[model samples]
Target: MPLRPVAALAAACTLALLGPSAAAAVALTPLPQSVRESEGSLALPGRFAIAWTGCREPMLERAAERFQRDLGRLTGVETFAAAGPRLEIACAAADPGALSLEAREAYRLQVTGEGVKLDADGPIGVLRGLATLRQLIETGPDGAAALPAVAIDDRPRFAWRGVTIDTARHFMSIETLRRQIDAMEQVKLNVLHLHLSDNEAFRVESRRYPRLHEVAGHGQFYTQAQIRDLIAYAADRGVRVVPEFDVPGHARAMTLAYPELASNPAGAPAAGAQVLNPASEAAYRFVTRLFDEMAGLFPDAYFHIGGDEVGDDAWAGDPQVEALMKTEGLTTKAQVEAHFHRRIHQALTRRGKIVVGWEEIIDTGTLPRDIVVQAWRTSNATARATALGHRTIVSAGYYLDLLNTAQFHYGFDPLDTSAAGMSPADADAARKLHPLVGRFVTDGVVVQPMAPLTPEQEALVLGGEAPIWAELVTDEMLDNRLWPRAAALAERFWSPREVRDTGDMYARLAVQQDRLRRLGLQDQAARARMASRLAPGASEPLLVLLDLVGPVRNMAHDKRVPAAIAGKKIVQNLTAMADAAPVDSLAARAFLARAERAASGEAAARAAVRADFEVWNANHRRVVAIAQDHPAVREALPISADIAEMAAVGLLALDALETGKPLAPETAARAKVVLDRADAFEAASARPIFSFFGKRPPADLIIMVTPGVRRLVEAAGG
Candidate 1:
């Protein structure tokens, strides 16, 4: 409602271009004073009550049950008491009255004598109507429900809605995954692209290549039984699980299992902690064996083979790889990549698995016609892959892992049909390019980007997912990093783009977050706290949430502080309080105290504050130094200064709240001024820290400076 004029215009244009059938057709009306009690559900005078028909089909039934449950939970209405206007549900008869052709794709909700009858062509249409009904529900301060009357007929432009999860970086427990699958189904997402293997972790339990799990998994691989169970679980929820195994690159985990498959002359590590050895004969054999097992485990016909981020460095470094390149008469890494991938394609063919890799694989020009290229590098790559003869999945526009905003993801076109530079020109051109490209026969390219999908673009995208990369991820930090954010991703994958109106979705997500909490997801708790502030009645929750301060610590000034003292102040404060106590009340009390103190005007507060902070920092270092060696504290420290700074800020904010005043403005401003500089420092420092112990952090006496700053700020009452 507060949208800027240009933003509003842009949104309107986007909806109009997408077409009326694609957007939720609804009218917003003020709640009539006479019907204040009926603010949510069909209690309001202008509200629409919707009934369901033909929803008993197993899939529809399952979906309907979930939808009904979500509505009840979200609107906080108990249907059993029948206090609110009830929407009746029935399976349509052989000859139910029909709507006009224009309304065929969406539902027509009419108020009947007894209740509302929601007539739709099918279950999915009914589902859309349900979503519309959900949007209509509103609660007043006194718990009144209200809604506006409107006619909505909506359908998505794309049929296959999907999201991907990277199981390769850090293996997700089957339970955690099932919960994710359930979450997806609730949001109407139909597919799950499972990135099963990556450079850091090999998740498949390979019978033919036992060593893959034995060596690469570091005792964390999923058993074959688990994969089978997961497939069944996903199917039951109407979600297809498409497995991806990155190859010719991002293969360090595989090499760990079968060292022989790795390039005999090892090169520096690449993304995913993997560096594939292209010249190893053993690598080919090992890859084939792994694929054989993968094919058997994943029933879905399409398999992902990551071929992105295989830097040219590896190809140029190995002698045997060079020799092979010369023998094949290939001059570039692209050609060698093509040659190598073709071998994997042959292996996949034998196992009845269609290969899918990154855009780089297409850049090599050797993939088979059936292969799907997940283009992550650039839009040019999507068009190039399509032009070259490979089917493409547009991830370039969506890489949610890049910390990009959702609007950016929404604006991109998966198929470059509009661009003059790469659009298909004619029949002869099509024929020549069709043989090598996957898009020639079928509209093979589907855009499935990572998170941050606006409702409109999310609906427009074939689907979207949230990838969990391991650079800053660990077992302890996974849930905190992914949840709630992943829920937003699921919404994009499941809900139609037209249904997007972040305001409403954000509200619905709050209820979903509560549900996630009931389901025992700790990560969603952090997300709920962070996201709560974006909504009304959220200040209390946001204040209480114990934010992670490591990143804040890293963001502090260039002043090098020791790691031992990094989170010392926050940890000390937390230790002083009850463990796992609600951060909100604590934060509230502290903030009020600081406010009172600042208003009193204590100049002595300045010197006393600085000296107190210095002393606290020194004490924290001693405590943290001992704590770091305590084994427990030493194990969980983050590797990056950025994370450290973030952690420091979090701790300092908590302390500042406790003192009843804001952080010292001078220190805060100084930190802000140098934040960008800190980012660069972390980027340069991360490599050495990450590479120290085979991509793990190093143990040192001083600790990192990021965490130290966190200690200083927290001690300084901010």
Candidate 2:
């Protein structure tokens, strides 16, 4: 089946099919086959040429220059000229054509003047359209360039296309952040959600709270000037800068700034993680100052006061908090949490900006309607918030950092009526429904439902993003975790949904991934390499197999085989014993019994490993089959399965090594290793079954070792 657009695009497509103007609505489609031939190179008709007339911003100038240079390298276009060929490039402040499509946040590129005019809706859009145009001009023989004449009506479905960067986990250099922002513009994403503070550290410089950076940031905080510089840079790309100062929970950094603000009124423990004192006036004042600084620093008119995961137990036990809650008639801990959210929301709103927070803000119930709620929980919450008229953005089940399988991510829908019921479905069929959940919660509520959307969802979405959560993720892992996949998401966000062609994208991805590799990124390359190794007829002995196995367990969060696999070398070495010890004084029967015990133990271990494969593989099949029924699922499910299978196989290999048996002479001699030495190779290549034995199991698990093994075998092209 073909790929499906995200929630927004699906709606748009539905709407397009309704009336007289349906034919004119903008929709995504695959790039013309002729143009998509080259991965990074653009193939243009002989008659087309690109020219730039006016550019004032330094970034724009730099972007244009880079485009020109890349064009030369890829398609052999030494210079851009309006009169030279078929494609013409012109830079102007306004749309030069009488008839052109205008999008809200980006440049408006139009076909005009016997060629095409690059008139961006904004600088960001201009940059993106330029990239597209560049990709269209392909290299010909002897370093020559050409162009094509094609009309495209394009715009993003969302007003806030963004990528959330967790600067607090491990400081990402300003240069790195800026580069990412530049790329975001190229993909037409219009927002940057900077997670500047978290439980790990605080990364923004504040004069009022000098210690925030000095003590909490580990010397990795961004100076105020740096923040301003980033803001300005994003402004040029038509991207808004939204700063997050997570509160209540995830505020260990703040504890360093104001020890009295910790949940423990008695004060913070020596080595325990910090929690905030929601009842303290000082806590309120500190956060207010931070927001005040943020509002002044970021002019996006929307601020994120992270009202997420505030620990109720911490606040409940604090004497100071208890006293305050009693005075306020707050009987429950949830109420106390709500009070904190209300105070922070009020603080930000008073500063002339609306607030956005995780679904917990609503769970707390005191957040005002004007505050934008980001539903990072279940779709049920999304429906609840929207039904109540609050504007919400859904981010549940899409936490990229959680290391879930792609199928798990692909199964849910942002605009799904499953949570809201058949009323909306029937209404949609009747052409009378208008997604009243978000609009009905409150007259002023604006809900933005988001998660780390799949590439297919990106098409149906207003726009999608990749959120980098701090757990198990750091700046070092950023490029690896986000690349190629993130690039796929970016295209889905910018390109029209109808333009989707998976077979074409799969081919294109193969090339784009190489481009990323050449840019000094090997993580994405490793992922792709592992995927190929798992393909049928590919060599299983490739280095990628081992890596693939570990990642599979991480993706599924199933500890059975993976936990065992993690200790393969240890187990293998311990279990692999010499056949029978020649004990001169021992009784014959006793020696035989000892030998039998050893064999039984090894057999049990092998069974355990097999069990893990059974569980994971079965689930994999179910998920893949379910996904096949949904258009969006059908298109994006392969990545998840491929990754899981690789991880599983790798772990199984680790288990095999512990079997204590000699490998076949031919096998031992022929297999080339991906990692580890010859000894490690022998250990890893043993019987891929013993590493899974004897584990405490979860209750009522559906997908067992048998199914997991089968699914992996199938995926690995067994």
Q: Per-prediction TM-score, please?
A: 0.57, 0.61
Tell me model 1's lDDT, rounded to 2 decimals.
0.49
Which sections of candidate 2 miss by over 4 Å? 1-63, 73-103, 106-115, 122-124, 140-143, 265-273, 404-413, 417-464, 491-505, 514-550, 553-718
Runs in model 1 lying further than 4 Å from the true structure: 1-56, 68-72, 75-150, 159-161, 266-282, 313-328, 350-352, 404-466, 475-480, 483-718
Q: Candidate 1: how many backbone clashes?
A: 59
Q: Which candidate's TM-score is highest?
A: 2
| Cand. 2 TM to true fold | 0.61
Name the TM-score of candidate 1.
Answer: 0.57
Say which candidate scores most in lDDT: 2
lDDT of 1 by residue, 1-718 (tens): 1212322322443333223221222211101001111111345432234344554556556655565555555456554234445565553432221111122223455432345556666544565455445544555566555544433333444444566677776567787777767655444455678776767777877888787788778888788888889887776555678888887677777767666566644554332345566666777877787778778878877777777767656666678888998888989888878888888888888888778776667657655767876655445555555655665565554544433223334444454322212223332343453342223222222322323433443322332334545443334344544444455555444333344554333333444444555445665343344333332343232222222211211112111222222433221211110112221121222232232233343443333333433443344344344444344333223222333344345445545645767787875765553343444433432321111112112221112233334434545544
- CA lDDT, candidate 1, residue 79: 49
